[model samples]
Target: MRLSRRLEKLPPYLFVEISRKIAEKRAQGIRVVSFAIGDPDLPTPPHILDALVEASRDPANHRYPETEGLPELRQAIARWYRRRFGVELDPDTEVLPLIGSKEGIGHVAFCLIDPGDIALVPDPGYPVYPMGTVLAGGEPYYLPLREENGFLPDLDEVPAEVARRAKVLWLNYPNNPTGAVADLDFFRRAVEFARRYDLAICHDGPYTEVAFDGYRPPSFLQAEGAKEVGIEFHSLSKSYNMTGWRIGMAVGNAELIRALRDVKSNLDSGIPQAIQLMAIAALDGPQDCIDEHNRVYQRRRDRLVEALRSLGLRVNPSPASLYLWARVPEGETSVSYTTKLLEEAAVVVTPGVGYGPSGEGYIRLSLTLPDDDLEEGLRRLEAIAHGRPVRL
Candidate 1:
């Protein structure tokens, strides 16, 4: 069967490949401990679930929703930013509900980018960012994110020729896979760069509320002049343990929101009204839930980092997000290292090369397992490091 030329150009997802291997192991009856996917293991808070149940009973919820989103949800999202980041937003014009931030990330590319245009994307970044650009018929120019730059792309280093042709730039803080947080000064510089280059900045900020150790990740709009060139995506998936709920918001620049809404209206129907109600509950409710969630993740982060260090792998303690990015031992490619771990240790982790070429020789382990499961995974890793083999 022949696929569309556009679809054929896309790279297969490495995480999905890992998942297939996991499935094969499961088929063989192995109790494989998984640290590959960044999915929260915690259940959604009961109060938010109750809100969904209540909304589900309402007759109005059974109907199709507004593509732009429920007014109540948008207003709640707006209030969240104002309270947390001191960035005031017009709920009516600046906020658009997303199926999840991923959908917004993908569709926003199609909305803003034209064929043959260029987009500045971070290497070792979330796959969706660059993949979206490709699927939208735009060329992607990867800015290699290195430890020397603190894993943040240096906009000034991008050649002027590349900058002039770029229509969009995708950025994430408290980043996926790496867990590197960006500061306000960095965001200000990014906004300045975008304005100077006449490019739109899409800030994917799903992990802001999941930060630890007094680390507060700021909204891009908190930077001066950001509203003129930036749009930020937020999701309840990470902070509220609501990944399956599929509700998120894109807020900033009224023009960007309108373009997103117009594109969204053509693609599909809105998120379920019931889910929107629950998302509102998540935003407006007491944020003690966030604190508790962060506490759990912090414990796992500390435990995993210690465990990896014991296995002779140097891993930096993550300041935020659910991943521990660690380099594979000397003389092993990331793919070979991960394959050996899976087959011998019965432990699964994401190979860094799956993210991009710059990620070679590294691996990402997700701290999304229960305490017992995490300990067991670490034990398996230790055994593997000691040159012992285990049956899967």
Candidate 2:
């Protein structure tokens, strides 16, 4: 059988492949404690669920929903940005509801990129960024995000030849896999760079509200002139524990929004009306739930950081997101290190190389498990460090 050349060149997703291996091991009686996935473990708030229930019962919601989402949901998202970040948006044109930010990001690449076009992506960044570029028939020019640069890519280093052909640049603050948050100055510089290169900036901001300390993650649009060169993708998954609902939004240039919407219209009819109604509730309802959830996550983060450090692993406390990005000890490859941890300790973690090439020396441990599970995982990890076997 023959497959498209495009599909042939695409690499198998590392997470799915690793997860399958873990599942097979567990099937053979090996216990597994998975920390590889960054899925939020919290249940959806009752009010949001209740709203969905009520909406689902309404006879009017049985038909197709608006592709752009209900006006109420759009307005709610606009109000959210205005109130939280002081960045106002025209709900009608600037905000386009997405099934999830991942879909929006992927489709943006499909809509904007063509064969031979260049895309600037960060090394050690989200895997989807480069994969989506390839799926769209574009060439990716990786801008390495290294620890030496605080995990932020330097735009000045990109060659003029690549910059000239680059059509899109992807940015993610409170970044996935790294948990590195970008400051206002960094955003400003990014905006300037995008404008100079005449490229569209797709800013992925899912982890903004997952921040720790007193640090607040800034929206790309908050930067000077960001509106002209950037569109920001926001998700309800991490912020409101609405991951399963698959609701998110993209807000920015009207032209870009329209282009994305056009591509989406052909591929999807949009999420269910019930979900959009519930999303509106999520956006407008009291947000104290987020504060409470973050508090729980913070406690877990503290405990895990302490435990890992005590075991001689230098773990970096993530300021945002549900991940702990830690460096493996000397002489261990990322895949080998994570595999041993999973098999010996029953604690599954993400190999950093799964994110990108620059991630070779690290692993990402998700904090989505319950406190008891986290504590148990830590205990097992500690036992392994002390040269004792973890008996399941």
Candidate 3:
């Protein structure tokens, strides 16, 4: 049987290729120091685990769950949003749980995008944004996020005609790959742009709570009138180190939430009830755990940033998220530099080209590795800088 035309248009998934290469290296008995994926290496906190253990013992949780989400879980998310971002949400209408933020990010396009419609996506942003748009038979119009613009997309740069045709405008921050955070002023402008263009603003917010050095990234819903035109996705994957739990929430614009739920209802049975119960504990439980974790990430970030800088590479220090985006030497491609680091140093990193064309000269390194492994990777990087004829 022939594959669907949409499936045929898709390229091999980027992360799959990264993981394949890593597996190949490991097969050769190479202890590759991986900084590829954004997956947290930490375990879920005991409080959440304990909650899940207790909740799972109940037969009620073993059955099918509401596709919209658990009532308590939605309420817990609402309360968490109020306390964290000062954004109030109606648990019943404005919030929906996701298998993971990635699922929600990938599916939101199907809710709003029609065939041949446009999706405005950030260059060097999450791959899911454009891929999802393409899968839904929609066009992806890239909005370049250059370093000079503080790695934020400039609204004025987008052609007015493209914006008019766009059904979804996706934004993420404490952004992926780049680790750039967005401010309220930017969100306000983006909200206005989406409102004027009749686009659905989809904010992928997994890193909303993953910040450092007293930096607090604002939620898209916090911007004035954002709830009228946007939906923001949040995941326990990053903030709570519960990646495997497969639970997250999308909040804002009740209509958009309903649209996503309609699309999801046919495809998924909702997250497991036990996971939602555990998520309640994650949201309402002590947040000090996140703070402690961020402290570790901060230390890792500083050491990595310092290591990159000493090698004469230009890198903007990331104040949030678990990544450091560093520019490669002049005239070097991202794939070549990253491949060299992998081969010569046995240190695995993500090539910026994997993110998008605008990321051609950069590479992203994750801070998810343990301190000792990270230190060793840094030492290896330092050795390369000294012994090799690399462009620093």
Candidate 4:
């Protein structure tokens, strides 16, 4: 079948490939222990779920939702930002609801990128970032998120010509796949860079609430001068175990927010009213679930890190997010190691190369599974590491 040039430029969505491999293993009757995707296994808190049920039952909510979002829900998101980050937002103009941060990210890119423009994207970052640029006919300039840089992009290293031509700079902290947390200083530098480059700064912050060690991730808007140059995407998925709820918020620069909303308005309907109400409850209600969720993820992170280390894999447990980014064992590429783990041990993990070229010899394991399932996955990994022939 013939495809559009833009469609051909895109690679297979990362998780889709992982899911396919997992399904293939399942078809062969293997009970694969998956640590690939970051979809939380925890159920949504009852309060949020109840809010959804109540809203869904109301006839008033049956009609089309406001494309900008329900005002009350936007206010709830604004309140969340104010309370957590000390960044006051004009919810009416500065905040917009998303069908998860993923969708908002693409829309933001499309809003800013013209055909053949440049976009600065993190290597080993979320696939959506580069894909959005590609779909918009923009060229992606990958900034290596190396260990020496503490996994933050070194803006000065960006080519002067590329920086001048770029229309968007995409960033995320407590990042997907890598789990690298960005500090306020990093955001400050990023804001300054974007200001100088005159590009839109798009920060995806879905894992902000899923942090540990008493570490709360800050929003990009919290940085001095950040609101002048950037917008942040916040998701309820990780924070409230509301992955299927499809509610998120875009906040920061009012202009950027409006631009993204304009793009979204043309392409999609706003979030469902029931889900919007549920998001309100999730945000404005008690944040105890966030702390409790992080606690569980911390335990799983520590356990999995220890288990991987015991098998001589070099892994650092991230203080934020549900990922353990580890170097592949020497002598094997990311694909080779990940493929071996899947076929021989029935252990599923994401290959780092799927993230970018810089991720060549690394692998990412998500800590989103239950304790027992995670333990079983660790045991399988250990068995493979010990060079044992397989038997479940």
Candidate 5:
């Protein structure tokens, strides 16, 4: 049997490698503490779960749902957007619920990019951006997200010809792996750039509600003219601890939403009706869970920041997102340091290079582990710092 060329071109998924390493260690009877993935350790709120239970029991919810989502869910999403970001959306044309934002993020490439087209993908970004473009047979033009530039891609540096040929500009904030946040001013500039280049902007914003220090992240759609040229993908995964529910939405340019909807309609079934109802509950119900979850993540971020600093690893304590990006200690590459921690401390952290070439010198630690595991991971790190042997 022959595999497709696209499958051959696809690089190994980052998290899959991390999981493999963890399984290998565990199979040897070594208990590992991992800060590798940005999945929330918290449970879904009771009210949201209750909504799912009730919806699941309804016979109507068992049938195939509309690919565009339930009208009530769409309206709820629009209402939430207006309340949260002051960005009004047309529920009928602008809001399209997703199985998860990842699904839309991947499928949007097919919607916008033809074979041999170009996508401006940020280096050190979520791997899905470039991978999706690749799967669609589009070339990815990597824009380095250097720390010196606040991790924002410098649009001016892109060659004129490359910009002209690019069909999509992929962005994320608060960003994955780096925990970098972008404001509306930057988003406005991005909108202008996209307009000039005639590119569609895809902003992955799953971490917006996961901010800390009372700092709220802005929606790309909140920028003037952003909705004219871009779409924002948001998920209930981080905010409502609903990752397992597989519910999310894309809101913005009606044309882009419709294109993505068309791709989705052909490729897969829509989000389960019960899950859509639960997502609606997440959107319209009390928002206090978001603040509560942020507080917990904030505490963990602080503790991890302190621990990493004491070990002489340079980390900028970010104001948002579920990760702390830290430069590895001098003389160690990301993979080497990651391997060292795994071997010596039974700790698993994601190597930054897994994100992109620009991520080579760093490692990313997620703030989504339980407090007990976090403390133990800290102890193990401290043990390594102090030149003491881990008990294994």
Candidate 6:
């Protein structure tokens, strides 16, 4: 059978490969403690699950759902924006529920990119940004996010011709892989850059609520004129321990929201009504769960940072996001360091290079593991750091 050229061009997804490696080790009867994926180990809040159970019991929820989500769900998302960021949104026009933010992030590419169009994607960023553009017959012009730049792209460095040809700009705060946080000022600049280039900005903000140290990440829409040129994708996955629930939303420019909605309407049905109810419960329900979850993550982050620093790996005590982006020991590449930890210590971490070339010297460890597993993993890492052999 012949595969499409696009499919041929795509590389294996990063997380899937990590899962495969983990399975291989587990199959061999080896116990591996992984800090690989950023999936929360915590449970969804009880109130939200109650909402799902109630909704699921209704016969009305079993049927196919509208591609545009329920009015209540959209309104809940709007209310969330207003209360959290003081950003007003027209639920009917600027908000669209998604099966998951990943779905919206990928489909939004089809909305803006025509064949041969360019998307300005961040290097060492979310794979979906570039992969989605490629699948949509668009080229991705990668912008390197250097440590010196606080992981924010320099808009002025984008060549004039490239900017002119680019159709979209992808930004993520509390970013994946890097655990980098961006301020509203950076977003304001991005909004200006998008307007100057006539590019639509696609800001992935799933990690916004997964912050630590009392740091509240700002929404892109909070920036003046952001609604004129960009849409932000947010997910309940990280925020509410709802990764398995697969409910999220896109909000911002009305036209962009409509375009994405139209694309989704034809491609697939909307989120399950029960799940939508759960999401509404999440958004409108008590927000204290977020603070509670962040507290747990903060504890884990502090312990991990101290351990990594002692081992001579450079890692910041990230203020937001459920990840610790650590530089590999000198003379080791991301893949080599990751492989050493997996094979030698029976520990698993993501090789940063999987995100992009600029990530070649780093590794990302997730803070979403259970406390016990985290301690065990740290112990193994310490054994390796101290030049002691790890027990198989």
In candidate 4, stretches whose alpha carbon ends up further than 4 angstroms from where it belongs are: none
- lDDT per residue (tens digit) for residues 1-392 in model 2: 98778887578987788779788878988767777887878898999999999999998899998788988889999999998999989999999999989899889998779999999998888888888999999988888888878899989899988998999989998988888889889999988888888999999999999988767889999998988887999999999898889999999888899899899999999989899999999889989898888988888888889988898888889888888889998889899999888778878888898888889999998888887778788878888888898977
lDDT of 6 at 116: 94
Error at 243, model 5, angstroms: 0.7
Off by over 4 Å in 1: none
List the lowest-lDDT window of 10 residues for candidate 4.
383-392
Global lDDT for candidate 5?
0.93
TM-scores, each model vs. reference: 0.98, 0.98, 0.97, 0.98, 0.99, 0.99
Q: Compose the digit string of candidate 5's lDDT tens values, residues 225-334.
A: 99999999999999999888888999999999999999999999888899999988889999898899999999999999988899888998989999999999889999
Q: Pick out the ten consecutive residues of candidate 1 with the lowest summed lDDT.
A: 383-392
Residue-level error in angstroms, candidate 6, position 288: 0.8
Backbone clashes in each candidate structure, one number apiece?
A: 0, 0, 0, 0, 0, 0
lDDT of 6: 0.93
lDDT, candidate 1, at 84? 95
lDDT of 1 at 254: 97
Deviation in angstroms for 289 in model 6? 0.9
User: Model 1, 23-70: lDDT tens per residue?
Assistant: 999899889999999889999999999999999999999999999999
lDDT of each: 0.90, 0.88, 0.90, 0.88, 0.93, 0.93
How far is 228's C-alpha from truth in model 2 (Å)? 0.4
lDDT of prediction 4: 0.88
What are the C-alpha RMSDs, in order, of all predicted structures?
1.0, 1.1, 2.0, 1.0, 0.8, 0.8
